[model samples]
Target: MRIIDAHHHFWKYTAEEFGWIDDSMSAIRRDFLPADLKSAMDAAGVDGVISVEARSILGETGFLLEHARQNPWVYGVVGKAPLSQGKSAVEEYLAKTLPGADKLVGVRDVLQGSPIEVFSDATFNDGLSALAPHNLVFDLCIYHNQMQATIELVDRHPEQRFVLDHIGKPNIKDNVLEPWATQFRSLAERDNVFCKLSGMVTEADPTNWTAEQLQPYFDTALDAFGPKRLMFGSDWPVCLVGVEYPDWLSTVKTLADGLSESEQADFYGNTVLKAYRIDAD
Candidate 1:
């Protein structure tokens, strides 16, 4: 399979810049750059990676774009924009940064921490509208509770391409499936929206999470989005908090063992290529 790890990150770790890397995440407190990721991708037979922004800053996007320029294996970037800056500012930033448009495939905000109502804000919606004209995707990085807002956002901007990062970030650690599964299914009804099969491990009981533990959530996504709309992503350095790269890849592979060769292709790589407009070459 032509494997594309659709959601990993590359960062020069500094506590002040990435305050999310608290003492609990001490294992990933060090720097993680292209060289470090390339080694892991090579070992796991991953062909390339779509670098997602870890920090919700424009500088982080610039860093990924520079990394993409330097590293061929960094296939594309889902970078951050100042969404709170309102529409005109976002449009200006996109015009400036997207001149290198081939590598800058999408934009994201760390919505997991923001108020759900942010999705409904006039400024945010206006900023989102700007992306459709540029043919850029938006990566929705929200928690499960925010799905209603996400659904409303996706519905309002039917022309915009949105990918739900982390499958709406289910609370697998608590084994709470109710509202998440239902809301996820509702969100999947929007044809313009896609979902990433990423970030599950950290949502689970990190240290002792089994493949079996992840299967239900995986199955829910598969059933809801089907292989064509669902793409695989490692959620990398964050994934390392719960499971190693190879093991996580293996677990996804095993869960997908029953898929046909073509279905496997979509999950492993093809879906991202289409969704992000990644230049596979």
Candidate 2:
């Protein structure tokens, strides 16, 4: 299987960006680079990877791009640029590095707790609209609370492609489903929407999550998106809190085991490639 781990993060120090993984999950309290990821990817048969954004000094996609430039195995990057800055900013980025630019695949804003109703904002729309010429995807990192607005944004930009990160950071830890599943199914119903089967283990009971516990949401996403719309992602270093890279990879395998090889291919790599316009070969 030629796997493409679609969502992973990198940072220089634990004390820097990932204080979220402190005393409770001390195992991976250090920086994890491409070198660290390579062995795990090799073990899991991940031929290439897409480096996702790790919150930093802001407008830090340059750091990610530089890293991507350094690594052949890093197929591309879903880096960040503030879309709410208006289309002029977006145009600058497009003009500066639109096509084949350091494997830059998309833009993302971690909208978990931001006070902005970006979906309703003209500037935000202007920002999203700006991405049109660049032909890149958008990585939507939101909480369950943000789904309605996120969905509205998606509806507003039907032509743009998006991958819903961490399955909208559902409350798997509390075992609550209800509105989350319903909303997820609804979002998946959109033609331009895709979901990343990543970060659920951490969302679940950190120390005690079974494959069965996470299966329903995974199954529902698969049902809604079909194999071709769902992409496999490790969520990497963050996944270390509950599971390591290899373990996370196996969890994906367990969820995907029922599908035949081709369907598995879509979930593992093809869907992400299609979503971001990356070449598989």
Candidate of highest TM-score: 1
Q: What are the TM-scores, per candidate, against the unseen true structure?
A: 0.98, 0.93
TM-score of 2: 0.93
Off by over 4 Å in 1: none
Q: Tens-digit lDDT track for model 1 on 1-281?
A: 79998899988888888898877779999999988999888888899999998877788888898999999888899998777778899888987888755799999988887887788898888877888888889999999988888888889888899999999999999888989999999999988888999999888877878888889999999999999999999999898988889888999999888899999999899999999887686
- lDDT of the candidates, in the order given: 0.89, 0.82
What C-alpha lDDT, on a 0 to 100 scale, does residue 239 get in candidate 2?
Answer: 86
Which lDDT value does model 1 have at 209?
86
lDDT per residue (tens digit) for residues 93-188 in model 2: 667665557599888877787664666899878888777567778888988878888888899898888889988988888888878888888898
Clashing pairs in 2: none
Model 2, residue 273: distance off in Å is 0.8
